[model samples]
Structures are given as C-alpha cells and as structure tokens.
Target: MSVKIILAGGGTGGHIFPAIAIANAIKKQQPDAEILFVGAKGRMEMEKVPQAGYEIKGIDIIGFNRSSLIKNIGLPFKLLRSFVQVRTIINQFKPDAVIGVGGYSSFPVLRFAQSKGIASFIHESNSFAGKANMMLGKKATKVFVASDGMEKFFPAQKIMITGNPVRASISLSSITKEEGLKYFGLETTKKTVLVVGGSLGAKSINEAIDAGLEEFEKNNLQLIWQTGKIYAEKAKTRAEGKFNVWVNEFISQMEHAYSAADVVISRAGAMAIAEICLVAKPAVFVPYPHAAEDHQTVNAKHLVEKHAGLMVKDNEAKEKLVSSIIALAKDEAKQNELKQHIAKLGVSDADTVIATEVLKLIKK
Candidate 1:
C-alpha cells in the first residue's frame, strides 16, 4: 500500500519551503507516497505548493495579531471554521501521517489528525518553538528539530535533531561565483553584499540600505538587494542609474544569489539561517524584533556565540546595519572565519534524514 502523508504549514517561505523539501524527500524515498499539503487560505503556499507540482487544500485559518488586538476579534471564529475545514480534509485524505511545520495552519490540521489517532509529526525549525507547535508536540509521535536543546518545548524522548531542510536548488547547487555574478549582472572584482529581509522584506533593512547606498559605492561594493514586494518600487527608484545595485522584491533564483554574495545581510529567521549556513556565507543578521518571543534574535545569537555571524538589532539597523556589513565585507579574515564555522552547522541531508525516519515509522 502506498503511504499517504499530509504536510501542513505556510505564511512564509521559511515554513513553506521546508515543508516542500520534506515532501520532495519523501517522494524520492517512497515514489508511490501520496503527498498532500494543507495550508492557510490565501497564504503563499496556495500558490507556491501548486507551483511545486503538489496538490494543496486551504483552510480558513488566521493567527492572532499581536500588533493589534482589534485585528484578532474575529480570530476565534476563524479558528473554529478552520477546525471544521480540517476535519473534512482529514476525512477525505485519510493520511497515514500528518507533519506540522510551524505555522497557524499546522495547528488545526495536526490537532485534527492527532484526535483521529493517526501518527503526527512536528518539525520545529526554530530554536524558540511557536505556541501552537508546543501544544501540538504533546501528542506528536515524533518531533523533528533544527538544533539541539529543544527539550524544553517537546518531550525529550520524541525529539530528533534533524536540522532545517534547505531547498535542494540551493543546498545541492553547483553554481560557481562567476556564473552567479553573471546572472546578477555584477562584476567579479567587486565585493557583493546580498541583502534580504526574508521573503516579505524588512522595512528597517530596506530603509537602512537606502540610507547607505552611497557608502556601498564609495567602498567599491555592489549589492543584490531583495526588497520584498512592498519595497520594490521604492528600491528600484532609489537604485536608478546606479551600477552598484540590483534591486528586486523577491529572488526567484536564490542559488545564484548565494553564489554571488561575498557577505549576506538577512533577517535571522530559521530557514534564512539554515540557508545561510548551507551556503556558508558570512552574514550580518537583523533579527525581526516582533517575531514570536523574539525568536529571530535567539536564532542569531546561536551563530554570533559561535563566531559564525554578526548581528545588529532592528532598532539599531538604521545606524549600524550598513556599516557593519561594509566593515565585514572589508575584513577577509573575519569573513573566512565566519564562513568556516557556519559551514560546520550546515546539514545538507536533513530532508533525507527526516524522510527516512518518517518512512520507517510508516512501515513499522
């Protein structure tokens, strides 16, 4: 009998991509496995999953809005509706296992699956676990995590340190620096700073980089700036006639970006950190201060402590981000040190590890 699995998560590329990676790994190991993705309605996964050649079901789910209490007034209604939707999906898909990659959508689907006594798995990619994932971990058959010391969030015995799965295009890429530079229309002799603020863009990073465009040119450094969709127009206008900058809202080809980067400035989200590690680029992290429990900072701290990366606070970015990035760009020794240390943390085969374990549980 073919194994059926449900991969649930969304709201960001961080969650969506890892879920897809796991799905791909499972398909590779068990070609006959029927994989379905469940995500929040109107989220990126609805579009991205289909693009990845998988079927997806969307539930009417919304997370609590911590920034504004009034925005969450209807959250209870949405949650209730999502549970009903999850039940229908569960009844129809009848998955042998449900895997929850932390997101608002993961909760209802995994909760519904657990209630039905089906095996459920939780992948907590962050050092700081989400509240929903923590709650779901109680009954999860196995919990896959990116780093060590996740015992505080889940039952220690159920946890497996599988690392975060980076997309295959990046982790397995053979793209060279010269090819990457050509792809971005950049010169080989100039240092390239790849600025990314997650898939949605970081307003602070954008503003900081915009404020320092001249500094980059003065230092003979070039930029591959991903401004997210909201900042794209402004970033393009700002970089107009500037040969030192390449601005885009999203980078469709991240492998090229990784190859082109001499140093990276990024928000320290788990998936971003994972990709940076796999790419082995020295990075300056600007943790999103508003992330759940300031988890982004925790993710950055892990690297900083190990001398794998540097960090600037979100509030401090306007003054410090650009200078720090430029200084790091100029320092070859520090750059090489960060690169070698972070490379040790990279786990290129995490998808295979998680997939193999999931398949073993199914066979048992």
Candidate 2:
C-alpha cells in the first residue's frame, strides 16, 4: 500500500497554498501516495484543496475571536465536535502521518493522530507561533519553521528551518516582465505597481491607495491593483479608465501580476512575504496591525532589517505607501539592494525538503 498522509490547515490561502505545495511535492516523489486534506467547514480550503486535486473532509471547527467574545462562545462546543469528526476521518483515511500547517482546523486532526501513536508533523509559517501549534509541537515528530530562532516556540530538537513552501506558479514561472504586462493587458513602457491586501482587503491600504491614485498618474506609473473583494467595487469606480490603472477583486494570474510589477505594496502575511521574496521585488509592507501578537510586523521587520523591503505601518500607510514605493522605484541602487537581500531569503525547494523530512519520520 502507498503512504497515506493527512494534510491539514487553512482558513485562508496562506495556509492552503503551502499545504498544496507540500502535497504536490510529496506526489512528485511518491506518485501513488494517498493525500487527504482536513479543513474547516465553509472555509476557503474546502474549495481550494479540491481545486488542487485533493480529497478533503471538513471539520466543524471555529477559531477563537479576539474582538468578539460572544462570537467565540460556541468555540468550546465546536472544538469538541471537531475532535469527534477528526477521529472519524483519521479512522477511515488511515493516514501514515498528519501534518499541521498552523490554523484552528489543524488542531483536532493532529491531536487525534497523536493519540493513535501516529507520527505528526507541524509547519509554523509565522515568525511568532500560534498557541495551537505550540501545544501540538510538544508531540509533533518534527516542526518545520519558515525561519530559524524558532527554538523558543517548539522543542529545539524538532525544529527544522525549511522555510515556507511557495506556490509552483511563482517558483517555476517562465513568464517574462513584458509577457507578464501583456498578460494583464498593461503597457510595457510604464512602471507597474502591484498593490495587494492579502485575500481579504485591508481597509487602511484600500483607503490610502484610493486617495493616492492621482499620484501614480502624476509620476506616470501604471497600476495593477488588487483591492481584494472588500474594496473592489469602490476601487473600480475610483480607478476606472485612467488608461493606466487596472483594479480588480483578485488577480487570478499572480505570476503575471508579479512579473508585471516594478514594486509591490503588500501586507506582510507569511505566504505573501514568501511569494514576494520568490519574485524578488522591492516591496512596501503595511503590516496588518491586528494579526496574532502583531507577528506580521515582525515578518516585515525581518525583511526591513536586512534591507530587503520598506515598511509603512497600518496607521501610517495613507501618508507614506505610494510615495515610498514611488521613491524606491526611482532609486536603482535601493531597488537592487532590496531585491538582492529578499532573494537571498527565498527557498525554492522548501516543499521537497519538508516532504523528505515527512517520509523519513514516517519510517515507511
């Protein structure tokens, strides 16, 4: 029988994309390996995982709400119910090992596997570990981290710095800059700015860019703006037919969008940071202020400290993001500095490394 693995995590693309990357790598090595994905019901993974050609079972899990205590009231019951669901899924899937990619949905899946004496693995993508991953790390056969110095979060012996697994679309893209621009129907002669606010829109980033569209025109820069679903309609209204601006709810061809860019304006989510590093673009990170323990800022600062990227705070983006990116684009020296430093951080083969580790720990 071929190796069977249960890959779990994801409410957003951040966790789902890496999980898919790891699964793909495993498939590359073990062509017959059976992969099952465990995700939260009604979450993005339910759609994304199946789209990636994996079978997924959704658990009735809910993450804790930091802002609304009332919304979290049913968390305990939901968690209990999810644990029952996890046990059932594992029993049927008969997975050789379980991989937790850091999200509430991953908790029950890994926990149930551990109870059965099954080897469990974890991949912590953030600079700061989540509480669930910390608890699971105690028994995780190995914990994959995106960066070093994570010994504080997991057992030092188990922490392996494999970096985050970026999408194949990004790592293996053959698209050239001009081709990328043409794919977006954007002009090649203009400097293109790719503005992204994760999967959900960043209200502050949206407002700032809406206020600064004129500045792009003033400086003769073209824009490839991803306003996310939240701000897409209003952004389309503000950016329509400027002859230089392309505003959309999402960029389906991210590789092209990355290729089309001269500079990026982005939120500093771990996956976003990984893709940016892979693309080697000079970026201005506006760290989402309310992320768990402000880890997004820490992720951005790691790049900023290495001179790989610039940062404007969530509160400060309105006044600084557009101008800062404009200034960085003009300075060839600074752009090269940021690109070289961030490029040094890219890990093109993280999924393979992680898959090798998983196979080793499973012992056939």
Of the candidates shown, which would achieve the greatest lDDT relative to the real structure?
1
Clash list (residue pairs), candidate 2: none
For model 1 the local lDDT of residue 59 reads 92
Error of 1 at 357 (Å): 0.7
Q: Candidate 1, residue 304: CA error in Å? A: 0.7
The list of candidate 1 runs beyond 4 A from truth reads none
TM-score of each: 0.99, 0.98
| TM-score of candidate 2 versus the correct structure, residues matched by position | 0.98
Q: Candidate 1 on 242-327: residue-level lDDT in tens?
A: 99899999998999999999999999999999999999999999999999999999999999999999999999999999999999
lDDT of 1 at 14: 98
